[model samples]
Target: MAAQPSSSVFLETYGCQMNVLDSELVQGQLVALGYSICQTPQEADVVLINTCSVRQLSEEKVWSQLGRLGIQKRRRKELIIGVLGCMAERVGATFFDRMPHVDLVCGPANLDRLPGLLDNARRNRGMQLSLAGHTSRRSATLSRAQDGVESLDLSRASSPIDHEQGVPAYVRITRGCNKFCAFCIVPYVRGPELHRPPAQIVDEVRRLVDQGAKEVTLIGQTVNHYVYA
Candidate 1:
């Protein structure tokens, strides 16, 4: 009998602590389903490039990384590529009109739908997208990290080592937001805040640490305002 091959994955992320935490969530989910993390895009069977939409330069950097992946996909047709997190919600796959090679767009809320989304993308050999956001109120309390998470930085590029085990994992304890700061897009896009519960937050943190994560960050607008009582 022939032995089946294991899937290898690589995630390249650019943005805040929330985005990094988002990547860890994706990583955790993927590993649960039997995928091993890869160090480089070239060494991956699946490559997920998570991004941020808070800045124009960040957008530029994401496109630039995707540009290199487009070349890799050309040579490796079976390699699956995905753009998850904020950028997925922010830009969708429009950045790929010229790219035409992206395999999936997982988005922020749709990350939990990843395996299925990737399956569909593979079956169609076309863009698989979902930036519609989650419908559950748990999205609010589901904090990726109640402790705190950092914003993204487009200027620096993380090496494979940085992503080897992934930096501080994020554990979403909340979702959506009422705050619509001028020149920003949280309320308009994410809606009102939704919390997941303190117990769940603790559980997520324990799970993260069990998986080799040493730090955690809570995600949301005004994350400090969260109340346990």
Candidate 2:
């Protein structure tokens, strides 16, 4: 391991506890790759905005944060910019159109490939390279990032943990949705539901437990109807 930096990252998490957990997961992964935590965005080399999109208003917040960070990116050329979680998947490459400032754009299912993609984006400066194609268009497998860990260790996390009982630790048990519910747009935007492997789901649960998470929530808009072939 490299020397822990006296200075470190400024990871601002938005949306729900799931997003928070995703941010922690990113922190844990970065720790493995030799990055330390930083308290303020003013003193950081990387600024990761782990975002959400359950509502349009929430999406706006993500963009607002991006705009603020855009200024920071201009000030610090080495300051990497990236987006994570729902909004990235929901909007796809179109996100670049609205916020061409972000260096990386990643969706929910692409979390595992984050470290590699982050490296790629820092070198190349692109969105789709960070978010898409990790799982493949027609593929229905879980991310390699989900492997090994049984559950997120809530206490071990460097940041504050939301100890919300009954709220399952933020785990994307499945991705995409088949239902075209009239009021919603996930099925149309994220495409049909594709459940991950059953054993893999259990494995993620175990990982979360190891991470200090007491509860685990299975995700997907219409998660109840999900089934694997």
What lDDT would candidate 2 get against the real structure?
A: 0.64
**How many residue pairs in model 1 have overlapping backbones?**
29
Q: Write the per-residue lDDT of candidate 1 for residues 1-229, one digit (tens) a residue.
A: 1112568889988877666656765675666566778788888888888877777798899889888988888898888888887777767668567678887886665566777777677667567877665442233333443322211111012212232376655566656666678988655444456565677678656755665667777776658656654
TM-score of each: 0.75, 0.69
Off by over 4 Å in 1: 1-4, 133-170, 188-191, 205-217
RMSD, each candidate, Å?
Answer: 7.0, 5.0
lDDT by residue for model 2 (93-201), tens:
7767877777777765566666666666656645544444434353444354343222323223443444334334666655567666788755544554556677767
Per-residue lDDT of 52 in model 1? 77
Q: What's the lDDT for residue 3 in model 1?
A: 12
TM-score of 1: 0.75
Q: What's model 1's overall lDDT?
A: 0.65
Index of the highest-lDDT prediction: 1
